[model samples]
Target: MADIVGSMRVFVRVVETGSFTAVAKENDVTAAQISRAVTALEEQLHAALLHRTTRHLSLTEAGSRFYERAKAILADLDAATDEARNASVSPAGKLRLHCAPGLAQSTVAAALVGYQRDYPDVTVELKIEQSMPNLVEDGYDVSLISATQLPDSIYVAQALGSAWSVMVASPDYVKRNGMPLTYDDLATHTLLKLETPVSPPDEWHLQSTDDAHVLPLTHAPLQVNAPDVMRAMLLNGAGIGTLATYSAVEDLAAGTLVRVLPQYRVRPFTVFAVYPSRRYLEAKVRTLLDHLRATLTPALEAVGERVEAMTNTIGEAAGQAAKSA
Candidate 1:
C-alpha cells in the first residue's frame, strides 16, 4: 500500500498546480516519484484521480470530490500535530494531582502555587489523602507520594527526594516529662505513635549515620493515624512523636517543638512522582514534576540544614547541663 496521507498531500498540490513536476520540485523529489505516489493511491482507491496530458493536468470527477475532503483531512492533521507539538513549548491544560498525607503542605503546596504562576494557562486539581490513588481509575495526572518503599504497580515512579522523620516534643512536654536520650530511654517515655501508610504500627527505626536501631513500639499510649492529629497531641504535651521535615519545619523554627533525639532520626522516607506512563508523559505533568523536584528538593534540603542546626544547639545544651551536674 502507498503512504496515503503523503500521496494525498502531493495529489492535492498537483491538482492545484496542474503539474506533477511542480509538486515534485516543491517536495525536493523527481516528478517520477510523485507520479508513482499518485498512481499507487489511485490503484488502492480503484479510481482515476488525474487526467494527465502532454501540457495539461486535470482532476477527474472522483479526484475533485476527494481533493476537497483530503484538504480538510490534511488541515485537521496538521492542526492536531501542531497543537501536540506546542504543548511542550507552552503547556496549557488541566493537571490532576493526588498527594499523600503531609506531602501537600508547606513546600509542596507553595511549589504548586509557583507552577501555576509560571504556567498561567494550566488549571490544577489536587487531592491529599492517606490512601494511594489509582492513577488511571481516579484520573490523576501525577501522584506525589512519600514512602520507604512503594507498592508494585503499572505506574512509573520518579524519585523526587528523601526526607527524615524526627522525634519532636512540645516545649511543655519536654519540660514536664523530660526528653529521651537513647532508644532505651525512649522506651520509658510516653510514645505518641503516628500510623500512616508509610509507617508500621509496631516499630520505629532510629537511623543514625553508622547504623539503624529498631525501637520496638510494643506500647503506644496514644496512637493516631494522621500527622496533623499527632502534631496537635504533641503540642498538648501528650508525648514525643515522629514528624517529617515538611510537617515540623515551622514548629522547629519557631521553638514550639524541640527535637527529642539529636543523634538519631527515624528512617528517611523517599518521595516519588508517580504517573501512568513515562514515554507518553505530557508537558503539563512533566513540567509540574520538574517544578516539584526543583522546589521541593531545595525546601527539604533547607529544612535539613535547620534540623542539623537545632540538633547541634540541643546537643550542646545537653552537654553543658550534664557537665554542670
Candidate 2:
C-alpha cells in the first residue's frame, strides 16, 4: 500500500500535466521513471491508467476516475502527516547541493554551516566541482553557481546577488611597492591572474563611472585556479591579483587586504540558486534557498557599499593632498 501510494502521486501528476516529461521534471526524475511509476500503478490496480504516445499522454477512463480519488487521498495523507508532524512541519532528509569550487569555498560554505544550525533535520552534502553539472542527472537538490551569466537551461533559478572583482594586495605589499593610483601605474607592478569560471586569465577589464581600461600585463606568471587560493597568495604579498568581493569581504573588513584601485571595478559575476523545478519543491530545498537569499544578498550588497565608500575616501584624500601641495 505504501508503494502504491507513492506511485499514485506520480500517476496523478502525469494525468494532470498530460506529459511524463513534465512530471519527471517536477519530481527531478527521468521521464522513464515517471512512466514506470504510472505503469506500476496500473499493474497494482489491474487497470490501465494512461494512454501513451510519442506526442502526448491521455488519461484512460480508469485513470480519470483513479486520479480524482488519488488526489484526494494524497491531500488527506498530507493533512494527517502535517497534524502528526506538529506545527512546524519540519522537513527531515538528506539535502544535496552542487557548488563551484570558488563559491563553495567563499560564501556558500559559511551559509551551510549556519543553515545546519537552523535546520537540524537536514543533512547537507556539498559537492565542490569546477564545472556545472546537470541537476537532475547529478541528483543534487540544489546548485549554487557563480558566473558572469547563467547558461540557458530548463531548470528554475533564483539569483541570489552579484559580487564584484577587485584588485587587492597585502598591506605590507602596498607599503613597500606603493599604491597604483591610476591604471597606468599597474603596468609597472607585478601582476598575477586569478582564474574563475567567468574571468579570463590573460587580461583584466577595469571600469569606472567615467573611464574604461584594459591592462594586459604579460609578466609575473603566477595564476591560481580558485578565489580562496588567489586571496591566500595576495595575503602573503605574492602579487597584485583579482579577487571577488565575496571571497575578499572578510579580509577587507579586517584590513588584511586593501583594494588597489578603489575607483575602478575589474568585473562582476552573479550567483544563482538553481533547482530542478519550482512546483513541488522539497521543503528542505525551498528553505535553504530562502536562507541563502537572506544570507548572500546582504554580503553582495556590502561589497558594493564598501567599494563606494573607498572611492569617496580616496577622492577626498587626493583632494586634500592636492590642496596641501
Candidate 3:
C-alpha cells in the first residue's frame, strides 16, 4: 500500500542515520513510531534488519544489503519525480546570492531577468554589498566576486574570467584637468586616490608597462570605500577613479567616462563564482551561475577589447612624443 512505502522511507532513514531518535525528530514522529515501522518491515520481509545493542546500532548482513538497495530505490524515485516536475515547470526554490555591489548592479542584476524568465518558479534573493559575508553562517547559496584570487578556506569557485583595472574620469573632469597622456603625467595632476577594498586598505598596488609600483598614498582628495560610489564620482566628474573594467562597461559605452593613460593596463583581477561545492550545487544556484557565465562573458570581453584599443592609442601618442623630442 502507499502507507507501506512511506513507512519504508522512514525505516531507511533510521538505518542510514543510525539513530532512531534522529529520524523521529526529522519525521516529526516518536522514536517508538520508528521502531514499530522497522518491526513491521522486518515482519513483512521475514528477516531481521538490525543488530542492536544498548549503546550501538549495527546492520546485519541482510540489513546492510537491504539498506543499500532501499537507498537506491528512494534516490531513483526522487530523481524521477524531479524530472517529471521539471518537464512541467522551472526550478522552484529560494536561491540566495552574495556579490560585490558593482558587479551585481552592472552585469549580474541585468542577467537575472533572463534567468528568472527561464526558471520562473525560482525566487532569487541577492545581497549586494562591499564586504563578503560568511556564506555558511549567513545561509547564502552562492557568491560572485572580483579579486586577485580567492583564499583556500572560503569556497569552491569557477574562474569566470580575469579583468584588469582601468582609469576612468568623467568628460567634465578631463576637460577641467586635462587628461593624463602618460603615466608620468599622473604626478602633475591632482590624483584621485581609490581606497582598495581589500583587507589592507592603505596599499594601492598599481602596475604600468615600465614598472610595477606601490603608491603608499595615505590620503586622497576624496576616499569612497564602495566601488559603486567611486564609479558614480568618476561618472559625475567629481574626481577620477580606478575600477575593474567590468564595473565601467555601461559608462564607457554611453561616453560618460573615458579611459586614461591608455598604454598602461592595470594589473589583472579574476572574477569567480564561489559556491559551497561544485559537486553538490543546488538546482537554483547552479542555474543562476550558468546564466551569469553565459550572459556576462560577452559584455566583459567587449570591455577588455576597448581597454586594449585605448592602450594602443596611448602607445601611438608616446611614440609621436618620442619622435618629436
Candidate 4:
C-alpha cells in the first residue's frame, strides 16, 4: 500500500514537471528509486504505463489515460487528508482554467479578481487561448468558452450566459464618412472586416425587436484576423468593425463608438462553463466555479444593458435626422 501511494505520487509529479530527475530532486530520492517504484506499480496493475528511451520517458496510450484518473484520485486523497485534519474547513487547492481571448479579457479576468480576493487559500491559473483545448487531456479544472458545438462525451457543461456579435463604428468614422441609417447605406461606408473561421463569410445577421435582416459585407476594403486588434482599430476611429459585445463594453459606455441600428442586434452566441466529472470534487475547483458563476452574472448584465442603451440612442438620433432633412 505504501509503495503504491509513493509510486503514484512520483508518477503524477513526473507528468506535471515532465522530468523524472526533477521529481527525484524534489522528493530527495534517486532516479533509480523512482524507476523501480513505477515498475512495481505497473507490475501490480499488470499494465505497462511508460514508453521509455535513453533520453526520454513518455506515457503509452494507456499510460496517458491512467495519468488523468490518477491525478484526480490524488487530488481527492489530498482533500480527504485535509478534511481529516480539520473536519469543518472548506476546500483549498490549486485550480487551472481555460478560456477564449475575448471572454478572458472582458469577463473572466474581472471575475477572477474578486474570486482571488474571496478565497485566499485557493490558487487560480488562467490559460487564455483561442483554440479550444481538450479539457481532460490538458488537466484543466474548468473551461469558460463560447461555442455552439460541444463534444458529446463524458463531460458536464453549465450554460453561463450569451453574447452577441454586432456592428460598431467609431464616432469619427460616422461623422467624416457618414452613418449607415439602413442596411443599404452600409454599402457606401467602409466595412472594416473581421476575418474569423467561426463566423460566416462576408455575412452578418442582425435582428431588431420587430424585423430581421442579413447583410453581406463582402465589399470590405480592409480585413483583419484578430478580434482584439479589430476592436482596437474600431475604437481608434480607423473604420467600422463587428465583434462580440463583451469585447467592446468599456468603449461603448464612454461613447467613443456607436451601434448602427438601435433596434437591431444579432442573435446571442452561447457561453458555457465546462469541466470533467469526478466521483469526488476538489475544494479548489468547486470554489472557483462558484466564484465564476457569481461574479460573471453582473458582467453579462452590464454589457447587455450597454448594447440596448446604445441601440436606443442610435435609433432616436436617426429618427431626428430624417425629420430635420
| Top model number, TM-score | 1
Residue 314, model 1: lDDT of 71
Over the stretch 1-325, how does candidate 4's per-residue lDDT look in tens digits? 5568778888878877777788889989898887788888888878999888888889988889989999999899999897755422465566789988788888888898888888787788889877668888998989887765566878878777777877788998888988777777877777777755346648777777788887788687677767888888887788777878898767777878777655567556777888887546666666777776777866787788877777777678878999999
How do all models score by TM-score? 0.81, 0.69, 0.67, 0.68
Model 2 C-alpha lDDT per residue in residues 291-320, reported as the tens digit of each score = 998887787687668766765786798899
Off by more than 4 A, model 2: 1-90
**How does residue 56 of candidate 3 score in lDDT?**
80
Residue-level lDDT tens digits of model 1 in 144-172: 88899988889899988888888999999
Give candidate 2's error at residue 189 in angstroms.
1.6
Instruction: lDDT for model 4, please.
Output: 0.78
Best by lDDT: 1
How many steric clashes does model 3 contain? 1
Query: Is candidate 1 or 4 superior in TM-score?
Result: 1
lDDT against the true structure, per candidate, is 0.86, 0.82, 0.75, 0.78
Candidate 1: Cα lDDT at 30: 97
